[model samples]
Target chain A: MIGTLILVVCCLLSTERLIIHAPRPGRLRTPDLITLRSDQRFAQLKAVLPTTGVLGYVEAPGTVNAAHYYLAQYALAPLVVDYSPQHALVVGNFFADSPPDLSPNLLLIKDFGDGVLLLANKDVR
Target chain B: MAVALAAFLCFASGFALVSLFSSGTVPDASAVLFNLTLSAGFGLGIFSLAFFLARIFAISNIIAVDAAVLVCLIAALLLARNASASTNLLMFSPGADEQWPRWLRRILVAATSLALCGALYAAIMQALAHPQGGGWDAFAIWNLHARFLFLAGSHWRDGFSSLIPWSHPDYPLLVPAAIANFWTFIGHDDPHVPAAVGLLLTFAAVGLLFSSLSMLRGRVAAMLASLTLLATPFFIEQGTWQYADIPLAFFFLATIALLAVSDEQSLARGSSSSGFLALAGITAGFAGWTKNEGVLFVCGIILARQIVFLRAGRKRSEINPSFHRHSSAFLLGCAPVILLIIYCKHRLAPPGDLFTSPASMLHRLLEPFRFEIVVKAFLRRFFSFGGWLGIPGTVLLLAFYFIVGRGQRRGLPAGHRASILALFLTFIGYFCVYLITPYDLFWHLRFSLDRLFLQLWPSTVFLFFLLITPQKLPLSSNVSR
Candidate 1:
């Protein structure tokens, strides 16, 4: 009797999770947004970036967190994405409409037109 | 399409290899499922090893390497066709089907099939919703490493550079290398490859649980146990998240299952089943390759087997003559992967972060507050970790087991006892690691304790079910000892 009861409960709970987590029409979850948005954002930059080297990264301050940084890293893998602005080439992940305040040592090298900016670091030889 | 073909090839390679050791040429339904489940895991593991070696040797044509591997496995399979049918892998007893009423068996089977379909739907929906994977670890660690290996060409070793310390460069490369291997065959990286691998491993775990129970207990017990696993929402969630936890859990369960089967075959044949033990060792090695926690499990299993054998030897007045043979076979099977792991840690990757200094570790281990925190968290998560609705599934199941009472069998089967001991030792290892973790105690426990519990949950379920002899069934008298 106990075994039967547990099986019933399991069936009910599994059904509940199935119903709750099933993808609905026109619904985009955050993970989906991360993959789609990040891939589209970095598609062109990936072509210009060296296939294998460490590059400095700066994001719009407080506008994003580790998720965006990880997505950027994911989209441009084989190239190490460091979270500091100390390398010869740095990536500027700022909103296209809201341009980021740059330090004097950083110069815009190319704007890949999706808030994906390549900046040259004058501090490095 | 390329991903599908790669998976099929993996399945084929694994099946052929496992067939080399299995006893039965003509298998029953349950045995077929058991063989196929092991085949999936073994196939992926072997392919990953082959791919890693190919990379190490600077072989660019991975497709050719895989094809050659498949062809060699096929050749071995053909050559070994007439070897032996002396040992049965299924371990089913006489009159196993008659132990439960036909109607009850039908109900359990139907319910289990229905629940399986529902779980599959949920897993698919979850995978579709997160094509990049279900968690940050997937993209940041597992898939990110795959991208490195797939894209770096001659410089694949750069993926393990210290510049990306957060990526856990010291971790073993089974998942990453497996995904990258498939991508190399396809000639492009697709998110589908990892997603498919994750789903296959997840379901293979379910299938293993079901078949192993069916072989050991009866169909009724098997279905009920599998239902509990499928019912656990987080098991499915973690699996679709594409983290290594599911793969880790799969191998843990596989090792345990293989050990149990080996013991059963040894008892039935009146000789040591070294073949099964060798397979167990391989699975345990694969566990080590899956995650660092897996290395702990490998140690735990070794220690547990030693203690179990020692106790048994004490009762018998001398150690069993087969112990040395069994140990040697297991170590032989485990050697290649262990060597690979050694090379990976020493040559390719940076030092792991956990055991930086003994003094600091001992200092952390001595803190009473840390122990208290870890103990409380472990106790709390043990019941609630599966994220089941209302009453937690594990607690409920334990309560039911007590209520039903252990049947006439005086003790658990020796294999079951050994597996339980291994799991307990592994649990203790987890506790100790928690006591000495360098990260903030509360934060680390909050994030990882659940996954740690999850890694052992399937094997725990199998062992628990193995102990419960169903007395309420109509043919209880006929149930095997």
Candidate 2:
């Protein structure tokens, strides 16, 4: 009897949580913009990048966490996006419109716009 | 349409495989539900294996391969169907004793159906809200791997390069390969594919729990057990997150259920068919293919079976060679997937993150602080893991279990004993993994501890129901072994 009561209580609690956590109808209508922007931001870069191989990645400094790095990696899969600028070819991602502060050994190869820059490691070759 | 077709193919393939192996003494309706639930996971696993091997062999046209495999499975299924009529396998009688009153059972059934509707609503809403799937892991890990497998073409091997360690290139490819296989059929990566897969697995897990319980326990017990799972809000949320944990949990639950049924059949007829054990092995192997933790599960279950096998042998004062045969059948089922995992580890994927130098690992293991922290975290998480609204679910279940007594009259059946022991061992393995974790102990636990628990949650619930009931519910009415 107590077991059944507990099951009843659990069911009620779950229903409550379900209602609380359910997304609003309006919210589902919009495209997931952050995901879209992330995918689109790297679209051109992906086209130019080699089909396979490791490439160095640099993002805006404070945003050096796994989230942004993994997002970029997600956008450019099959191409290993190493979270470092030591490779011969580096992909520079900056949030601001201006040029990112690059290390002296890194040379700008091309700016594909949208804060996505290609850099060549002068120290490599 | 492509997603639907792929899903149908997977379900069909799994149904055929399940029908080929499983026959029962349970009623036809219950058997269909049980077999269908198992088919969902099995089909997905089959696709994962087939797609992975095709990629390994550079067979880019996965559609043809899938279709071919489907044809072969159906043919074999037909043969098995004909052969089943002539076979004599042990079947257990369903326990009709102590059934709940009709009115109460109807109330419970009505309550369960309502809860199911609510869960379905929440899951669909969750999927709609995040059409791209949930959280960072959805995009970063599982989906990213799928994109690699689907888009990288012949160069898919590049995704496993050591250069990108954060994406967990070492992780198994069940989710990714299955998603990629569907994408290949669709001619593009539809984000809905993963979402659909996630939703399919989540409900399949629920369905498997309900159907298995219905067979093993009475309808009332089945409804109550399933209600507990459905009430766990976080489980529904996590399932929509498009992660591999739910799939892992499904396989875990499936393995235990199969073993329990197989053991019951053996006890009834004084013998066993290799079919059920073989199917259990396949599920265990797929568990390994689903996640790294699943590999640990495979080990834990094997150790569990060995312990049980030896005990039963000793009790009989002679080792039953049928135990050896069962074990071999299990191994035979596991062999194909295990070999694939070994190949992936040795030849394709980067080294996993958990292990480090033996000296460093040992030193970490010796740290008293780490042990204290992990224990406290586990204890806290144990009570709160499901993100219940009030009076956390686990605590309530425990309270109920104790108040009603442990149902210790028969002690645990041998299969349940092995399964419970396996889960306990798996928990120990998780604790040990935390002790020697290479990452920040806090971060690792924060990110993964709840998920790890969730992986075992469904099985734990099923086992709990089985224990509390303590009756030998009929597994099947006319079920084949």
Candidate 3:
């Protein structure tokens, strides 16, 4: 009886270990505006992003006016804009129209999509 | 109505028989009735004892305490009458004249008293710590209904309105309504009061069951069973939580005891045993009213009893007549509770969605299978040791298996065999019900399966101890073996 109990305890402890060591499924990666569409470019850009901060994305059909207003309202993260000829100069406009209350950490990077661009925290790689 | 009348008559008759046969001293019919009433009063006294203590400690409201006390008193009285009938029937067995040793009797009584104390202490301590809702069912269903009743007030009927979509409108309201009536008298609609009262009733049922089973069996069985139940992690935890599982378990055990008595009487000739059969039916009916799974238990017991009767009647001529008569009496006694449940479900509350919409019910039933949910649930419920029985029960079960053989051994009498069979059937019934449950079986099993087993813990332990305990030792033996 003592031997059997010991065996049972050993088996249970092993099962507990297996449960703890099981691999978890990966989460979906949030899109970054400044990263290029190529897998390698996106990977490189992802590495430079803040490890702890959230990645915000905006997708709307209308003009950039509404998107700009939403970005201003929720200004915690920099806007990610799709790489496009029209959005190339929008980085300058973002820097010019930046709210005085905006943290100095907000840094406008390059665009990734048609009109999408990436913003980064100044401390990020 | 017929069922209620039959149950009342059976109880009345059992009281008379107990009065007649008690210690070979027959009291008058009036005196018997008075004693029966007194026993009921005693039951109420026990309830009041617990309630008053709860109130004194500010653990429960006076109104909730009073209602719980009253219900418990009534249930205890009914159960005690049943127990007396059971004891008398056991005494009529051929070898019953071989009186129990005086020391053994004293040990039995002391052990039973201690078990009752332990169950009471555990329940009270749990309730004091978590007064409002200790069990999950109490929060998810029973107390939720109480909350609705209190909040809805004049529109309390609205509480059962199917418009809510989430609440089970068709569920019976006997328990919640009783609490609502207390709230009405106090002119204060406090949901906590009803929830607390429900917890008190749950504990009272556990106490009475443990005490009664102990008295019927022996002290050792009683102690083991009570300890198994009180120490069961889930049951003890829920004893503090407000849930209907404990109450349902109480009613389930009451029905099992009733059936056991009836079965015993079936074997004995010239014995007046119709009362217990009816009482068992009534208890089963109440069980059905308590919860949906209770209806399954009622079905299981009825089917098992019918099967037993048929088999017995085929072999013996004398068994035929009593089987028919007793079966009818059982059905007659069960009629009121059944009707009450039907009325509450169909007329008072909304129609059952599970059956009415076949498509929906089928969808729900098949969903568990699709996700490997039932397998997961079964494994979890079967292997988990955190229930009312806790570590002690696991140890006892392990010891029981090692000490007692696993397969068929033929030393036990027919009566003992039948009792064990009935217990096994009841356990299987609970298991099968969970396997097919439409709700989240995992959550349901986690919260309830253990406590449900605790309902039969006492009876199982009693049977176990009786079987495993050494009958006699050689006079010349040096060691205690």
Interface RMSD of each: 2.5, 1.6, 19.1
Q: Candidate 3 residues B166-195, lDDT tens each?
A: 446677554554444345444554434544
Model 2 accuracy (lDDT, Cα): 0.83
For model 2, residues B179-237, the per-residue Cα lDDT tens digits are 99989888988788899888988999889888777766666667878888998888999
Model 1 accuracy (lDDT, Cα): 0.81
**Candidate 3 — which residues are off by over 4 angstroms?**
A1-125, B1-119, B135-140, B147-154, B190-203, B266-270, B317-320, B353-376, B386-395, B401-481
Residue B325, candidate 1: alpha-carbon lDDT: 86
TM-score of 3: 0.57
Tell me which of candidates 1 and 3 scores higher on TM-score: 1
| Least accurate 10 contiguous residues by lDDT in model 1 chain B | B472-481
Model 1 CAPRI rating: medium
Worst 10 residues of 1 chain A by lDDT: A24-33
Q: Roughly what TM-score does model 1 have, to 2 decimal places?
A: 0.94
- Measured against the true two-chain complex, the DockQ scores of the candidates, in the order shown, are 0.54, 0.64, 0.02
lDDT of 1 by residue, A6-76 (tens): 65666567657755766763454544746767888999999988888899998877786777788888888
Candidate 1 deviant stretches above 4 angstroms: A25-33, A61-64, B82-91, B317-320, B470-481
Give the Cα RMSD of candidate 2. Answer: 2.4
TM-score of chain B of each: 0.94, 0.95, 0.67
